[model samples]
Target: MPTYEMGQWLLVMCHRTQQPSPDYLVAAFPTDEIREAYLSIASERAEQEVRHILRAFVGHSRSLGSFDRLQVLSIEALRKEQGREATKNGWSPRFTEYEIRALNHLSGTSSTPTWEGLTWALDLLPHAPQKAIDVIHAYMYAHAQVLPDLRISGLTDAAELIRTRYILQGSASIETLLELILNLDSRDFEYLVAHLYEVLGYDTEVTPAQKDYGKDVIARKINETVFIECKNWQGHVGVKVISDLAGRVSMEQATRGIVIGTSGFTEGPATATEIASRWPSRISLLDGIELIKLMNQHLGSEWHRRVERIIQSERSRQDRRPK
Candidate 1:
């Protein structure tokens, strides 16, 4: 794939019409060119993708300017709201700079259709548009690591820094890994594997292998079985990772297997395929992104609050330390 300038990103769309899409969409291209061009495009979405370095500054940041549906307070108002003084309503806020950052990350960026919209539409309609979702997730994964303008003096906590990126962008992938382990329901494995199948719009449940099988969860859909092994891996999951999950799938006599982990796949696709080929059924793959999609498909961003609560709880535990 070809890279564009700082202001543009490629939103890949397939069409059955006249021509193939070029490398990217950019405002630099001429209007006459657009009229003659065969591919659909949006330079605006591309520009919005990278405009925010800090997750907290996406749309509502006074610095970057305004976005739709959200009205930001003036600097004087914010200053007072930050507890510098009291508002006209006789209210003084306890909003720290960090919390301000957190607030912005929760809001959506420009030209992006957030899950908030999807949820609304799902309330009105039954199913989400398949293509729109794919496009949304692709854009999400593309810009997933973007940071908001935290505007801090220096970088000290790298984990927090990366976590902040996902926090603002509403990325399920990073939320799945690299931040916090959430929903340790003990039943989470059953739900996660079940939900993975659910995301694919299928019926699923645990099988006998789930009871005596090395696999913790078994999914059934349309006469197919997808056995799953989940681990809350904090770091990279390697060949041994694939092998262990693969073993569990074999014992269960499953048609397929999936190994879910919070970390990244240590081996490349070819190696993964090679390992999967050694087994009876092909083992499918899912890293952090897939896991997040499963969450969004079933749990939504609401799940993050539980993860955040865990963080807060851990922080509280640490805070009880003696000086």
Candidate 2:
């Protein structure tokens, strides 16, 4: 997870399960120890693997120039409807500089949300992301030596200074893709995985509809080849599946193998990972939650555009077909 700071707030990027896009949540901690404590607890409990820092900004106070003055000015125009006062638009005189910083963090450097789109921004204040809030409460309860005197009435913004770049443009499309993935047929899921890896510069092959040799997709890059087993079953994947994937890796002489399961792994499979690790072939397992993270990591700028094009083309093709 990457982090950003503006004045007194710390913004962290988080990707929800099955969602390709990231959401930015801001926090304010009084000391570095407290901040790190929060991160340690969050990382330990996070469902997805959180690594790699993409972009960061630190130690900078947000200024009025950081926001779009024009966008702000336009909000007043929308406050009135047909000559009489109607419902107020999102624009409010109560917006503080810290809130603006939060907005900027979420809006991404390339674009900022219009004032009308900030309906949820202010409400998010004084409460970090749901998970962060939970972790902070737990930390305070422990009363660790780092900040034994620290007390948090509520989440404030973090200001010691750190900020990271966040992309906002494709969030909607990515959400659509996540929904599509969750509802897609098992076959469609395999194809989607193949497509994602292909776009990421891999030479990918989807196995035949018949016997798939324990692997649904095979992706190769340079000398390394990855054999992937896709399991869309709703039940937990047991040791049998992992055992089969381990065998397939040896047969294919691949560099690695990954098991992607929608339901997740039972203790049988999870506990078996250590045994597989002893083999020459490395095996990685990802449940539904982790699968989404992998997709988010692999899919880059071209992803949103590609997803839109594919969806539109599919719709057109269906419309043109005979009834």
Candidate 3:
């Protein structure tokens, strides 16, 4: 038998007899090491996805403000079930039928799935050497977290008990995309700011630092300034947020103020125009996904590592937990 095939046999034994690595035959699952490995892989996968999604979705190299509308579509095909594919405007180039089937555990129909196959592909952490069963088990474990318990407990339509979650539409919330732009997280934020900053050549500092301000963020270089207020809240951000931030802008020795959030401006463009007429060039807006692109552009690979590390750490911790 091939080495990997041999490993599967060993894994099966280990799972049945519930033994550790050396002792293959066991009745219980090796939840600890498996979880750890799964998390490690997941963390790296999240970074890759973030980068891929940003580069692909934030296409045209245009400033986020330029886009008329943004939507995320699934990369997995109609047959793949609930696989949410794109984030912003990103898409996966391809996937096999079997892969798609395995990825659609939560999805009963092949018409449209919710999660993504890529997430399943990344389930195995130290998967350098493994077998189909091993991969399937890991897939089951991951899927079990979201799907009904019967999935892993072995009580569902076995064929439909596939092993993945896919995103159907990956669009960022209209409001939150803005928050990303005003505040600096990485390349995406930096990229947007670089362009905006260059547009007016405005430079001025915010009096209360982001940490001290207890809200929003600001940056400057010359006499001009740009104020940023980031909000991760759901629903539309009302005039209150903008008005309060405006108050802060007055306090800051800056030129312009921008409000950002996943929810975005509560007021429509017309209202925004009216407000802008009242306080022209005083404040602007950006939401979630937009924020990500700007940060990716500005910060680039630097923040990529940070994102990856955060995801990886979270996964690692999840893995270490007892089943």
Candidate 4:
């Protein structure tokens, strides 16, 4: 016979719609024997018995929603399933077993996990390995679409800063990092700029996805407040985009303005310089090369290699898919 420890039996309850809800609970049993005993009785009773058990363990005061499905999984089996799902989703720098354990610990009774919890969980792990930051990145990237509200909290900004610093510590060259950044979507690129500013000792905030008012990021360092616009486009950033940033800077009475373009500015650096000179407040233009240089100045040069590998793998996966 096999033995089981506390929290070995994972119970997951979901609403009838198959969507996870707060009313639906996730509870763990102490051992497999206890779980089996309950299941044997549960199989003979009506579904209401499960609700009674839930209310007994938790509290009857809390309202319970109708859950048509219940899943029983061992913690070990759940970890393996999550690992497979993460790999199938092309998550890079996959979460290690320790990281997964930390995540499970942090989730506790909550059905939804927040970015702050993820960051805190990583810190609490034994030995405090730095690769844990990779776990945060992987989870966020994989669940970004499914959990749109995950990034809403300020704590996530701090986590992003920490993750960015770790990435910067890698040996990837500035050129390679630039290429990797260029591959990011527009929203991610904006968030990356905000994180970079945070690493540079500035307090940064990425504007909401909607109603940004021409500014994608706001960075403040001491008395200096900078308004930034990010362009992840392949084509040159034209005068119009630069002009709009300048307008936002002036309107907000900001200390300065910056336009970060993955592609070079239209008509080259000279044109960008002339455009900035026209603005009332100082305006800095950072092309892809200049942006990478700035990033390399603060951290190690090698992290982009890992990111490149992940990107290439994703591309290969896509290529294999039927059109």
Candidate 5:
């Protein structure tokens, strides 16, 4: 006999004719095999046979009425929905399956996983190290407040090392840097903006992916607060985007608002001038060209071979450790 996990399969009935009525749960099974076995014979008898069997199982206790469709959701889909709900509630950071596996491998003995341990574990994985790094960066960006103390310190040190490496060896020119920035997905682009603010001496927080209230990042320095909206669009951002940011700025009482558009703003300089005149000091726009310039100014253009030195040093340090 094979054992099955509880709540692994959900039998949902869709009643399309019932206006404003949500999908009703007809039954919950421990496995898809069990659910399929229950419906297969009935389905083979007749199209309406499955419905009759489900109705008999329902025992007239519940009023699902007539359902036109039936859907069986697997455990993976249910877990994804639960994860989304958790993220929306800001209760936990969502991690992909690979990330969770890596973290679990690192936390074999202890309840908490440290950044250094995670890095070591990731080095042993077949996947590229950058994927795990992005996962860590995203987790740190969104859940900075609730991270363990040791993990926080370790992640801070690792982030500093990576940031220094990027500043030194990431790109040689503004054009190359802009190309790399453009290749990042929307979520990573938001993280890039948040990282830039942190580098610029402002404490930053990235809002949860869902329901961010039109702001992607919030930055604060001393008495000033800034709300940033990132648009990783291939086309130019329009006035409506700027208008929405302006509203959020006022609502959040932010000191200023900045929109970073990867493909620049519509109508070129005219749009920038119009926004400046309308919002004055309240809003600022940074197109791709200006964003590159700002990065060059702050991140510098000089290239040093420090990244190689750091790698060599790390290798030597690791080699000295007991095997």
Candidate 6:
């Protein structure tokens, strides 16, 4: 299914599950990590579906609470009935023939899934019958909070279950990445910032730390040049810092300026940057959260290259320092 449809399907499931008399129950599901990972790359239609449905169906407070439980159940149950006889006589025939066929087809008899294949099973939920959906709901409820135990529960193939687990675990790696970014030293973090600009299609130059003229990175996109001041401080970035960057932009005749702070900017700095918007050389502020969002979006294939560049830059700086 297209990502929008999948996202819409998940939204519908969340809304349906919210009903007091829902046809399916959601016991346990992948935490916020997996959902955020999917949402980061999911289509705008899917994102709007989530926002509109959650606000109209439940409320803003309950938006993030409804994870992709429906998709998870559908995939898990589909895998269990794969390659099995669809006869009405066996196992009390709880599922209809249509459900059986659908599930079996979705759960291909494969050993392991490629990276792209891991999320493929979730595409089965959009058109599944209520009976099949309910069966999955029950099974997942039974296996709730003990997912690793699914390998022994025999609900799904052991290899398939393990693969699913591994995929879900991999989706959660963004948290690790966030932590790593937060803990990076000043110089390494500056290189990362420069690399991020480069990935965003800017021609970037990292200025020397001591005499940077209040700019850490000079990035040019065609005719527009943006002077960037980076701060890896633990405390709030102040208005004076942004003012200095704005002055630098004016001095250098740059088109604009950016203050990228890992700790985030204070209200005063935010207001100052906003006020600078009226001037010829506008200045913008990017807090840690916003920076991370950009990194998550743009660091797809270039992620390893950016990391290597940061490491290499740090090593070069260390090597060049007087011994």
What TM-score does model 1 achieve against the real structure?
Answer: 0.38
- For model 3, what is the C-alpha lDDT against the true structure? 0.40
Question: In model 3, how large is the Cα lDDT of residue 210?
Answer: 35
**Could you give the candidate ranking by lDDT, starting with the highest?**
4, 5, 6, 2, 1, 3
* 65-91 per-residue lDDT for model 3 (tens digits): 111111111323442443344443466
Top candidate by TM-score: 6
Q: Candidate 1, overall lDDT?
A: 0.43
lDDT for every model? Answer: 0.43, 0.48, 0.40, 0.54, 0.53, 0.52
All candidates: TM-score: 0.38, 0.42, 0.31, 0.41, 0.40, 0.43
User: How does candidate 4 score on lDDT?
Assistant: 0.54
RMSD of each: 19.3, 18.8, 20.3, 22.5, 26.2, 17.7
Task: Please list the residue runs of candidate 3 whose C-alpha ends up more than 4 Å from where it truly belongs after superposition.
Answer: 1-215, 251-253, 269-277, 301-305, 308-323
On residues 1-323, what C-alpha lDDT tens digit does candidate 5 reach at each position? Answer: 33443232222222322222222223323235655454333212332433322332322322111110111122235557878988788666455533443344443643432222233323311122233345557756754643444445445443332333233223355566666667766766776566557657887777768978888988899989999999988788888889889988998788999989988877655574476558879999888777655543344322122323333443344345453
lDDT of 4 at 58: 25
Residue 205 miss distance in model 3 (angstroms) = 8.2
Q: lDDT score, residue 287, model 5?
A: 84
Worst 10 residues of 1 by lDDT: 151-160
lDDT of 4 at 41: 44
lDDT of 6 by residue, 57-147 (tens): 2111111012224434564565456425444336533543324433344455432211111222222222221222244345446536433
Which prediction has the highest lDDT against the true structure?
Answer: 4
Q: Output the better candidate (3/6) by TM-score.
A: 6
